[model samples]
Target chain A: MPKVTIDGHEIEVSQGTTIMQATKQLAIEVPYYCWHPGLSVAGNCRMCLVDVEGPPKPQIACYTQVTEGMVVHTQSEKAKKARKGTLEFLLSNHPLDCPVCDQAGECDLQNFYMDHGQYDSRFDEQKHKKKKAQPVGENVMLDQERCVLCSRCVRFCDEITGTGELGIVNRGSHEEITVFPGKEVNNAYSGNVVDICPVGALTDRDFRFKCRVWYLSSQDSVCPGCSQGCNIRIDSNLSRPQHGEGERVMRLKPRENLNVNDYWMCDEGRYNYNFIDRNRIQTASRVKEGVVEEILFEDAVDSLASVLGDAVREQRHGRIGVLVSTQLTNEDLFFVKKFFKTNLGMDAVESRFSFPEGSSDDFLIKADKSPNTAGAQALEVIASGTYQSGEDLIDKTIAGEFDVLISFGVDIDGLLGKEKLDAILEKVTLLAYVGSNHNETSKKAQLVIPSTVYAEKDGTFTNVHGRVQRIWPAFPPLGQARPEWQIICDLSEKTGFSVSADDAESIFSEITQTVSSFQGLSYEKLGKEGSLLSTVKETVEK
Target chain B: MEIPEELKKKWDEAVARYEEKRAALLPVLRLSQDHFGYISAEVEEAVAHYMGTTPVHIREVVTFYELFHTKPVGKNNIQFCHTLACNLNGCEPLIKQLKEKIGIKEGETSSDGKYSFSRAECLGACEMAPMMKINKDIYGPLDKDKLNEIIENL
Candidate 1:
């Protein structure tokens, strides 16, 4: 350990920790742009300049390693002057487009100008111009005139993705970041360049002019796109409904979790939140005599209870099948398992929903598309070696083994093709579909109940690595939709189970008491990063 | 583009000098620039393929250095010194004379494709003052007639 004093604050750090990393522990903010903790230090952006007691000139904090008993003054006159000069050089050619720039509220250049630089402009020459609004990739747009030449995006493409699609093309004042003449920056994680860009140079095409960042509220959540369970922040404008016709989710940003996806997420997980607002089941409905009619939430719950009660009274538990989805949270799965086993005495509960073949990389992506398949296994919702695959489930349904089928968050069209799904739907008597979206399964089902998406609920998901992470609600549930756990609890009460838990936190505590895999974990204990269960399997496969 | 077998052997020999393949990028680029008239996109891609890197990395290096040209040049490429020492020693008159006599500006090639001219920074011949180089040959400390005679002989 080396003891370093930064701005009169003393702290001991590891041998090779940089001055920027040490100053972070003392709550000293050193403005930077090109120095990302996740990427190699370029040290080209001189905004992190700090005065050292022994060094002859000011050094960039990102590249200078802290020595034992070294003294550093980050707010001294020399350091401040150096930072101001760096800011002046950066802004000398930067166009004044803050009012129209998407990164105005969160840009580092705008922030450092107010913090370290307050001088008048000294540049009287005509500002250099380059390409504007160039489409570089499928999801990223580039404005070359607004770039600060940080090389963050270029380094990101080269180092992180191992796809060197970007580079500084010219020299000196003519230097501009661009791709090769005919090639484009198309990759699995190309949208991350837009997130790593500290200025308005790169902007996301999906969220370009959607909404200003100041009007949106953010909440920490886990991406349900895959089993990697990358941590993310969901930004939504819940109050302002007049923006884009009830589309609440403005964008999804990567939340830094060093153990998980550290400061970076794949484009699939980053842009997967659009389904939360599009093609959603806003209200409950039921099919009556070949005509679909919207029904009340209480009526839908009562109708489902009557079907379960009739099956229990007639000793027909073997005919009642409940098909759950791995997309449901751990708390939702736990409640569904307990209700099916203890209340209805149903032994046909299974999770036969298979996700489509999603692309995977050596990085954060996983071949398993479900976010909580491990949690489903841990809670015994899908029993080991007894659960049927998606095709087998469709075969079993067409054979008339299960007269009453209950599904949650499982897209039937995706599992089996439309022909097979339609064949299975014709044989089932009472089909109750509970999901977030209006898919083929919900359209043909006799009963359709809307369930809240992951962004509108608070729960935990056990990833492929068996690391549990918590998701906080960024906004209220749309229409009459409710969390699956709450809906399950209400239905259980209607069926005379009396689970008595109305909220996710209480049900999570009950789950911790009963489930051995979640024995010692509680909602409060599983902080934003979440705790890993002690009993993770050696090798997890789907 | 396919590099010649001799140049490919030279590139391999150059690559063998460095421990890491990425370190051989500059020398390999120089070799390609010498063999070809200039480093084109195809040449950059070929070098990147040979060095196990990307074309953007090769492009970054070629654009950063002043010696490597990315576009095609004439048979005789003339580089005029434009540093403070050369400017104070009457390099401006030589530049003007070349521009008028060659019927082309600093970065333009001649109509017959025999000559091309460009202004360059210091060539490390400050003692020779107003110096210029053409095809690996440096001539300096000369008047207009001496430069005209050299051009006429060429």
Candidate 2:
């Protein structure tokens, strides 16, 4: 380990670590733009200039490697002057569009100007005008004038995704970042460039003009679109009712988790939160004699409990099939296994909701669309006996084997076409559907219970790699919807079993105690990056 | 999409001289430009394929260097020096006279497609202060009459 002193704070670091990284270990701020940890260091931006007690002038901390007993001064007078000169030169050609820029609140240019360079405007000449608001691709909007020539987005496209769609054209002040003529940056990870861009040069078209970032609050969560379980931060405005809309998630930004997604996620997962606010089942409903009616949550639970109790009393519990979705959280899956298998003595609790195979890349995108398929498999929620897979469950339902069925987050019409789903609906006497969205399954169910989405609950999702990560609630559940674990616990209480877990934490504690795979793991132990399951096998396939 | 046999042989020879194929991109680009007169998008793609890189990488290199032309030029390309030494020695007047005679500004070709004119940074010929290159031949150290004679000969 090489010891380096940054601003008089001594710390030992590895040999290859840069001074900028060592300063990070000391919690010292060294302003930088082009040096992203995920991308190769370009070191074009001289904002991180630091003073070193040597023969050379102030060196850029991002490019300078730490040596033994190296002394660095990040906030010295010489370094500050160098940073100030760099900022002045960068702003000489930059447009004064902060008022209209989408990256106003979080722009690095504005931040560094305020922190290091508060000098008066020395540039009285005309500012160079480059192209503005150019639609570079389907997801990205490029403003060439705002670019600081960082090359982070270019390196990302070339190095990370290997798409090689973007490049810096020309030279000097006339230079601009652009894609090849007739070629669009339409890669799967194209949206990540906007996230990595330090300035408003590359803004997300979906999030542009939506809301200023300071007006929105963020909560750490995991993406539910795929089994990669890429960690994310859900940005939402809970007090935006004054803007004529209720609380809603604005966007999903990738939260850095080196083990899972390394500061990047696919555009599919980034934009998948649009369904959270659209077509949601606001209230519980029930159907009687082919007429749908809105019912209270308590009455809906009571009716479902009574019907299940009657089925158990008639010794027809074996015919009662439960179709679970791999989309459900681990806590929800645990409760389902406990209540259905141990308490009700029902042998069939099937997770037969198969997601269509999505396009995957060598990067973070996974073919498995469900985020918790490993959780479902590790907990043994997929029924073992006759109905093994989702296709088998649908086939058995069409064969008139199951008289009653309870489904969670599984779209029946999507699984089987309208014809087969209609045929199965005619044979099933009691159908209970519990989900967050208002899909075809909920429309035809005799009892519909509204469930919370991934953004509205705190639970663990064991990713495809068997890593158990936690997702916190960004906002309250929409309308009368409740967490899936609470719904299961309430239904279990309504029956003969007395399940007393009230919150997600309590149910997770019970899971750690009872589930062998989840033993010795708690919510606190999961932390931000999450911990892998103890019994996770290395050869588990996605 | 087809390279001339001579240029292809030169490109392969240049590639063999370097251990890394990517190091041969500059010479391969120069060979393509020499054979085809200008490096089009298709030429860039061909060079990129030969170099085992992407077209954007080749484009970045081509656009960064003023010597490489991405667009079409006339039969005779004229590159005039615009650095401090040339500007101090009446290069501005020479450029104006050349533009008037050629009937085109910088970065544009003549209407008859006989000549293309561009003002480039120093071509390392500062000792011959007001110098310009006409298709690889440097002519300088004269007035408007000499420039007219050079253009008439071309």
Index of the highest-DockQ prediction: 1
Please report, as a residue range, the 10-residue window in candidate 2 chain B with the lowest summed lDDT: B135-144
Fraction of true inter-chain Cα contacts (below 8 Å) kept per model? 0.73, 0.70
lDDT on C-alpha atoms for all candidate structures:
0.87, 0.88
| Chain B TM-scores of the candidates | 0.95, 0.93
- Evaluated at residue B37, the lDDT of candidate 2 is 86
- lDDT measured at residue A303 in model 1 versus the true structure, 0 to 100: 97
The list of candidate 2 runs beyond 4 A from truth reads A242-247, A352-355, A537-542
Locate the minimum summed-lDDT window of 10 residues in model 1 chain B.
B135-144
> What TM-score would each prediction reach against the true structure?
0.96, 0.97
Steric clash pairs (candidate 1): none
- The two-chain DockQ for each candidate, comma-separated, is 0.78, 0.77
Across residues A1-542, which tens digit of lDDT does each residue of candidate 2 receive? 99999999999999899999998888999999999988888999988999998847999999999999999999889999999999999989999799999999999999999999899998988888999999999999999999999999999998998889999988899889998888899999999999989999999999898888888999999999899999999999776655315538888999999889989889999999877888999899988777999999989999988888888889888888888988889999988888888888887788856667988876788999999999998888877676678767767877888898888888888877788778878888888999999888788888899999999988999998999999999988998999888887888888878876868899999889888889999999999999899987555332
lDDT for A262 in candidate 1 is: 84
